[model samples]
Target: MNKFLFGLLLTSCSALGGNSQYVNPFIGTSNFGATHPGAQYPNALASVSPFNVAHGGEQNKFEKDAAWNSRVYIHENRYLTGFSHLNLSGVGCPDAGVLLLMPTTGPLELDAREYGSSYSNEQASPGYYSAQLNKYAVKAEVTSSLRTGLSRFTFPAGQSNVLLNLGLGLTNETGASLKWVSEQEVEGSRMLGTFCYHDEDVRPVFFVARFSKAPKTFGVWKKMPRYQNVEADWIGYNDSIKPYPGYRQLLSGDDIGAWLSFDTREQEAIEVKLGISFVSMENARENLDTEQPGFEFDKLRIEAQKAWDALLDRVEVEGSDEQKTLFYTALYHSLIHPNILQDANGDYPLMGQQGVGNSKQNRYTVYSLWDTHRNVHPLLSLLYPELQADMVRSAVAMAKESGWLPKWELYGMETQVMVGDPATAMIADSYLRGIRDFDVNAAYGAMVRAAEQREHNLLRPENPDYLTLGYVPVDDEGPYDGSVATSLEYYLADFNLAQLALALGKQEDHDKYLARALNYRTLFDADTGMLRPKNRKGEWLTPFDPELGRNFEPAPGYIEGNAWNYRFYVPHDTPGLIQLLGGPEAFLRQLDATFDTGNFDMGNEPDITYPFLYNYLEGQSWRTSRRVRELIAAHFGNHPGGLPGNDDTGTMSTWLAFSMLGIYPVSPGMMDYALFRPSFSKVKIHLSAEYYPGKQFVIENPVGDLDSDKPEAFTLNGRSIDKPFVTHEDIIKGGVLKVK
Candidate 1:
């Protein structure tokens, strides 16, 4: 065995103690969460998810909506076309559900409409999936390694075939190329980009597929235009499009595919293994050879399960079966993105550049930083310090290659989606928590460059105005909105930068950024007790309504939410927020009114920490525990539609995970965790000793009444604490947290 394979086996063996059997991979597959019950190892490069929505016929009725265009939508149950090899989970936008593979019997059919089948007896777990194709009488089972996907298909007697569909995918970007290496192997590449309609940074993903048995007959298929008459064909006029089959070694077009036909007996099984890479087809094959060298289906499936078990075992919990399912599933979802982006040989595509770059460690991608910076990175720093550090290194490397930090990066390309300089906050938070293995100096330099420079297509589009006027101005007459929201995000980013600057002993930068971090105060309107829009003339915009932007409607000064939700988003300075709202009694009254008047949006990130703000108050902190429990019970479950909203690349799940663990990081780039009442009686966290000083951190609620409205007293390591918070240093040092 190779050294990399040996290391992976050792890692998987060490993590075998966790109960991965409790993980329900289908938890957030419905209710618009956009999660897929795919077979994937934790933080792996590829996932084999069922592509059911695109099948024609009765399934088309339920799949007509725009939401069905997502990576995988499980609500529609009429047909099963194939299993897509690369898919995104719990994301709002569509990207990278390509490289589809399907099995069939009888005459070979290339069209998805003709080859689709109805499926039943479906089952899924972490790193494994299985389904019975009723129409073809084929049983399909799949498992995965970090960079490869393995599938075993059982077919009945008669002519059997396996099809590789390159044209049909979840992405809006089209065009692909495929080449056959031999009867049993093929290589291909597909274009992927246009995330949320931003199409400037398109890139190609390459893959290699190998079948266990060589096909008796193999050929390629394409959906080409059909000519009507001889005269019309001479004039290049076409009547319709049809699938044309041929024995071609190479094919390239917007719609093309390949098929392999095999003769098999009853209950005969064929296994296909596929490897994917963003760099080259050679790397793809190498990844497959190194990670999964053989067609050992059951053995690989068991290893995948053990891989997940080791990851979930990091946080062992004592709870009911239902709670355990949700917790482990959330943890599972949290580790899917920021996935390993480099090939096994450490070769990765340089962001915004043409050539491939090499790194010593895994170069991670899919950083939904605007959402994940709030909680996901903090959770990783606490439990998986080495992985978190590698992610930080990935960000720093992106900045070096692309000349700007990534906002919503995917597969080595910046999508420029969402607002905020959140990568800075995430890196700063990790560094403060002792995840400093990355180039801290270079990271700090990147943060400073993003904060000071106003570059095009970067996060700080309104940086000039922000620097000159202390905030981004509302362009009511023009196309721009979200001035208030953007400014507040910048303020948080600046706060995190200031903290990092202070830690690095750069006093001048510390003073400059610390002053800029208060820019959110300039947008606050004392008369309305909420943030409002300001024009270039430094005056509040006329006719403001705090509740105007509800349910994702565009308001004059907000993005995806209203002033009520964004008002308390000053997590870095809650005391200042309370002071702005008046005294403690008035602040509590207004906060209570927000919940009573139905202004709370649990599905969004800005208001996620709103319920936890009560912990900052001394005697009234019990309200946080009460509200957290209520939200979890109302929104989260073990069913298909379990999550309240899009997982935002596991940000929502991380929030639930931290809440159930009885602690939350109120602010990134800070060490303190806001305490809450944990759902379980006992919780144990296995900390990585490479970065943390402790082996384990335990939380015990001996009362066992998770429904308790308030926590009366708290102690850490047998010492009494009057405050409702604990530092990262405190937890990493190892101790028992007892709440009463």
Candidate 2:
């Protein structure tokens, strides 16, 4: 089918049925967006992604470095190493592209440079991927169950081989053990930690791999140590990871792998099933037997597609083909993380511990709370309320097991990557929005603990000083000097905690935290009218520049952002911010100037909500619409480099999805959505019955030109409303929001 016809068919199908057909997984796969066109169910444990960006291949085009090392294949890279199971998508750091399976023919070679091939005829959907290995004349297709990955490879007539390159992974940590379980099965474990180079609390991931057909011959291979001449004596250096042919029953080393050769005719196909677990190899096999016992690739693929379609069908929108594709793809990316971390039998690794625990419900990992707390969690609460509730439960469980709330959790381990106590905000927001399935008191206690604990609190490293000084002071000589940004994040977290406390009838705690939440006032430099760095004695830092932070450069007191971005970050108290900026007139002027002068950083999270701040002003809300439309057109599109920046575990994509739907959760721990002109002609959100009273909520823009900045007369359920905002309660009550 031609591109035009395929697009037309997708449009027709979306118009008549579900909208999952419009999802193009290829978007955000290049230009440092770091997304992959992998195959996985929404929030599933296992994903099968093309592992093509690694070194040691003639067709490999990318340089081997920290910048180029990613979880899976980048769109620009042009080599095929294998199909790796357990991959992460849209993450800035590399981790968890492990358990590689590559199919080849003729002479057997263990090195990726010798055996790896170039691939073409690539195609991917929500839960299915296929590519043709041009060098080996093999067709590779992959699909997945919740915990298991399934791959079917069609080989040309000859001696075909499937290589399980356990040593070749996408992580800095190396060390693996492979043992043959039977003639057709294998079980092993691989070390997969050091997320973002933290190195602490590394954990082993065990796997069980089985073949549908028994191999004619099977053996193991290891990278032998290179001989180094030392004073005329040859000494072996283990650093050289070159493949050495071996048939050992058990191979355990940094660079060791297994291979299985088969005698087959032309177009012969064989299936490989792999199961993964953080606990043990037995649980890995259990997961495989429980989730996917058969070799039915088509069945699993279709079932995975249906699962995605069902999830995407929750929100129906009518729009242009491009708009629909972008909307669904963003939604797809938003559901790929906070994955189910427990095995089928409910066994999971204990966070920061040496033991394992069992849970009745699925434990979730890969929190990335600092990023997802902005919009991703809010969107999930609105759309997938039950899943959101489970996520909250998982967080509470993690805190109870690990002694603290997660900052950047991965596989039950706290990575401590990014600043802020965002888990509080995420849980508070979800509970306030009525998705209260977890222990609220326990959650509140966890937040209080995080707030009070000074030492060993990863979320707030400067807690004691912040509590005493009402702000984190700039440290001229210390390594941790992101005081302004950290203080601002703490204020936001405190504000959310205050809201939760107020709702739970803890008036004293509410007042206490609310007072602390006003610490943003201390950072404001009235003379310059911007939030500047303050010393320990409440003195302003000299020679401050608002636009100094750009191109990933470090600002004096900011984290990955500048003053212009963090200045408008007081979302909890926008009125106070406006007051500090010399009232509404000056506030609007500065806000407009931030955009007019190109000081706004759309790719950065601190300023993502700046465009939506116009909705707070009465007449200037039109500017919000115009700026949002312009940003969407310029930064977001339907291509490989569609995203403006790192997806940040779908926070950026969630922003795009919400923008397209005409509503954004500008404030975390708040129930209301700031309204904007939606790109679609109509949008219908099927509210989850478990948490919401309404069955459906509709937003309709009958006007054809959604790009216009003019305000339309708005009515909710035939009642006129003046404000450009809708509360979560209002949405759950079910009504038509007619914009004319």
Candidate 3:
């Protein structure tokens, strides 16, 4: 590639104006937001993200090996070791950040510390990212298709080399195999799991990387582990990297890398396209050939940009530049996960099994269900019903293959990262919203099995205690405690299951599960006015503090939250809880105190709905609008530190997108949404003709003053509704909502 072609390509991309143009991929890259400014298509299987977490300890105060880091790129980090493909975004735990490719111009250096460079001039958008490596004076730019990543490096006149490091990543698991297929191609597989450090859950990712031109020299290297065996001297590299110059064979070890060196003219460009798949090596090769066929980097970039614009265009907004950037970026982050898992030939890894499965439709993976089921899935059902239906079908397939629905599924394996039967709620919520293209009967059966099976139940390990005692006591036998929080999650899951059961005409199951849903009353101690932890003898856990779990500190019986956070968690039976807390007045006072005293955490999902609970109280719906607006103003922006915290696989982003759109699906499996003021003057939700009856849904704020601290009352379609909530039917029916 030459300068003229590159300049023309940049001009062509700059000429196009779409909603994707407002998207700042760097918005959530800081503040522990866990999002990466990577080059990826919407719901893509592959992404190219800058890998800087390898060394940033003293300068940035954070490094992967020094602490529990979940992302590959940190905004403050200047060191650049490589660019990683197939990375996870906005997740709390680490996995799948592997297959690093680094370009350098110098002598061959296998050690990342010795070869890494300091980067500058970083820029990123929807489908593009570029940075200048100061150490090597090489410009690196990356773009991606659905399953393949393409990287172009402009090298100076000298010997240039590209190295693929397989040993370093966010995942602790090692062992990788690489083969120099030819002068222009290399293929291999890397073991990538032990997610959140759980040993049993593991899978292999296969990929084939092809270079645009044949290299001057290429070889594979291995870093042997320290061992005192007889063959140690024969291998010759103990606890050090051994490079095999010009070798064209297969090599397997704990830590290994392969490099391709080339003699290039000044400002010459070389491109590498990598295709990845979880199914097989052949599928990976097919994905590369089908997605790229030729080294047309600009064509792939434009296609990816268009693909993102199509999705972002679904909701058009009228707002300040900052607000539009925040909204679209949040939407962008929300769609990255639950990505396509099938290869070009529709082959995918079977869930929790040793076989290949086929799905002509998309087989989705990376389900952060415990986080996403809260708002992300519901948002998907409303905006992208077809994709949501495929996700539901994918859930059913996982249950069929693994004997249970996934809690936190990644690459066909369940890591069980968080508690709760969240899949039930997500399935029920989607089904209730008319996204029923999936096999509901099979899903319902799986739900029943998970709820009833006690002997070897993976989802509900404390099910026997809950069934026998009406609540999971703090002393019950389980993998981890947090009994009160765990029980609350189960009750919510049971409520959702009950709704689905009633919809399916299983009156008996509905009655049983609905009763179980209200079992939270057992843990609700009238003395503390909060749900306190109780032991098997029906005694409250002694020496308890309501604020024990603030800032992720350990609490006696809570998971990631405290008593104040879980106080109003009973969304299904809020009226009952209000009565239990004495009356509406007392409940309002307690809830207000929770916010006014700084107890309401906007960063975590456990209490994200607390702000909207004000709508449940009569004449106090104004508080919902006011508090939500305050949160938006304080937390979200159009910069790297914009997001509140770790996106939890877009859970927080979904909250922002829904909150800004003026309607939030506060409770999953419930049709009613808590209404608030729209952030923009007008928002147009383009409905799908195949799934929704109306062509569009409009939300208009005539006054359109976002900075004004006034609480705007909402009127649906011109009629003044007294309640602060609107049903899903009314929203999808397609009419204008006036925020007066």
Where's the lowest-lDDT run of ten residues in candidate 2?
8-17
Clashes of each: 1, 0, 0
Candidate 2: give its CA RMSD in angstroms. Answer: 2.3
lDDT (tens digit, per residue) of candidate 3 on 146-239? 8999999999999999999998888868889989888999999999999988898988899999999999999999886656556546443357
The C-alpha TM-scores of every prediction are: 0.95, 0.96, 0.96
Better of 1 and 2 by TM-score: 2
The number of the candidate with the highest TM-score is 2
**Over 4 Å off, model 1:** 1-17, 66-68, 227-246, 455-457, 476-481
The better-scoring model by lDDT among 2 and 3 is 3
Q: Residue 28 of model 1: what lDDT? A: 74
Better of 2 and 3 by TM-score: 2
| Predicted candidate 1 versus true structure: per-residue lDDT over 1-740, tens digit per residue | 23233223323423344567667777777777888887988899988988877856666555665344674646556577888898898888888888999999998778788899888766777788888998899999898989999999999999999999988888879999998888788999999999888878698899999999988898887777764567545546443324444455678988888889989989999999999999999999999999888889888888888888778889989887677777887888999998999999999999988899999898999999989999999999998888898999999999989888889999999898888889989988888999888888888878888888865637688888888999989964233348888888899999999998888898898889989988788988999999889999989988888988876877888878888988898889899989998978888988988888888888888889988888877787789989889999888987777899898999889989999899999899778899888888999999897888898999999755778774558899999888999999999999899888
Better of 1 and 3 by TM-score: 3
lDDT of each: 0.85, 0.85, 0.87
Clashes counted in candidate 3 amount to 0
